[model samples]
Target: MSNEIINIIADRPFNEAVQDKYFERVEAQLTEVFARPRLRSFAKSGGVLAGRAAETIDASVVGPSLVVFEERLSEDDKQDALDSQAFAEAVVNKLPAETSQEQRYMAYNEALSAIGWVTESYTYKKYDSKKLTLTMNDALLQVLETVISAGSGNVLSLVAAGFDKLKGDKEALKIVDAGSKESSVVSFKAVPCIVAPGGGMAMVMGGLDVFSKDYDGDFLFFTFKTEGVHLFQAAGIRKFNKRAFDRKRQQVYNYIDQFGDGLFKKIAG
Candidate 1:
């Protein structure tokens, strides 16, 4: 899929004018998302939610398993995480002795409650590999049309030459907090040194940011977000149109999150 996109963008004019600009725009948003204060808080409290992977403490969330923080606990709340064994026993008593399954689940809930979980909203997430392939092909097809004119012929030497142009963007890179580079490639791009738009664009940027890092030496990747978009839009590349496509796709994912199983039935129908 990526190789095909690369071939289309490999047109010299498009490479010089189109590719780096898209990467720069995406990178900017990723940098912004990664830099949020809450991320630092998450790192500082890194010991949290690590051990709950196997437990289903609450049906408030419907995932097979995922541990997410609802909120932060106050100091007194932290201190009050007392005698979980005792609380677990109390939970065991509250259920019928024959209902071992219910008792065990309730005990887990007691443990979670002793911690600082103060909220109860959930967004269920799922991914379809086949759908993902279709989506990628569709996105790439549009990108090719944007770069290649109707009669523009035989400019083929596999033009989408990766992100070799990223070196230019790196010269101006304002890297901050050298020590905070995230081990996770995705999280690293959305770090605070960049910007976030709080929507699908931000997500696309984050994903691209991770991609650049993951394939750093393999491609000419860069991220610029708003700056690159504005520059390219003014120059007639319509990079923002690509962003709109990404945003619209993201909105569909979000809709599915809210609709959950009902949406899945419609999708599979």
Candidate 2:
């Protein structure tokens, strides 16, 4: 006799309840991860501000298909991550609220590209404030100057003698006048811009355990446990931000949008 696949028990259908449970687990994991002292210290050292992670849930699929749940870093955290590593404060020129979303996104991309930075997964909410604030360490002034002189167009200038004068001046200087000529914006790429140790954990899914051989006639009962190591002081740095995860989620959304509900229905049914 062949073994039968057992379904997990839940108050609702297996598919619906499983998603809720998964998200609940994820939320608990994130809360624990953020509360760790080592992670908080690492973020503080990198000048990155800590913010709440917001969950984005998608349940458009019908039938037995898997649901998607995402926990993305807050916008404030993303902005802080970018500004923390910047060589100088970015001058932001605010655009009117009437400005079209496409126009704003395009403008921000163009401005960042002018400075040799490539952005990924640009969103309206990410740059909608129209204020790009980049604060760099005083020690990187020369490096900033080199980058500015090499490729930055009229968009960036260092006042009199470039960043050299601002090296020991102790006064903050704006490198890129994003609002001087035209409206521009700035943001970091969708990568692990913030580096920190013990910022990540590896999840392991255990084998399913059978709860009952027979339930409600044809239905069988079973459950599986997922485990992960919550390392507080591990070696090396990891990309603590969920930008990459967000990008993948966006790709899935795009696929679903392009293919329509029929595609999911076919797979689920």
Best by TM-score: 2
Q: TM-score for every candidate vs. truth?
A: 0.16, 0.17
Model 2 C-alpha lDDT versus the unseen true structure: 0.23
Expressed as tens digits, the lDDT of each residue in 1-269 for candidate 1 is 21111111101212223434443533453444333232111111322332443432211111111111112322222112211112222333334444533233334332222222211211111111222222221222223333334552221111111111212333212121121143222211110000112311110111111211322221212222222111100000111113223322322222222222210000000
Against the correct fold, how does model 2 do in TM-score? Answer: 0.17
lDDT score, residue 198, model 1? Answer: 32
Off by over 4 Å in 1: 1-148, 151-170, 173-213, 216-269
Measured by lDDT, the strongest candidate is 2
lDDT of 2 by residue, 138-244 (tens): 11222223222244322122221222332322211122211221322111111122212244321100111111222121110111111221101001111222343
The candidate 1 region of ten consecutive residues with least summed lDDT is 230-239
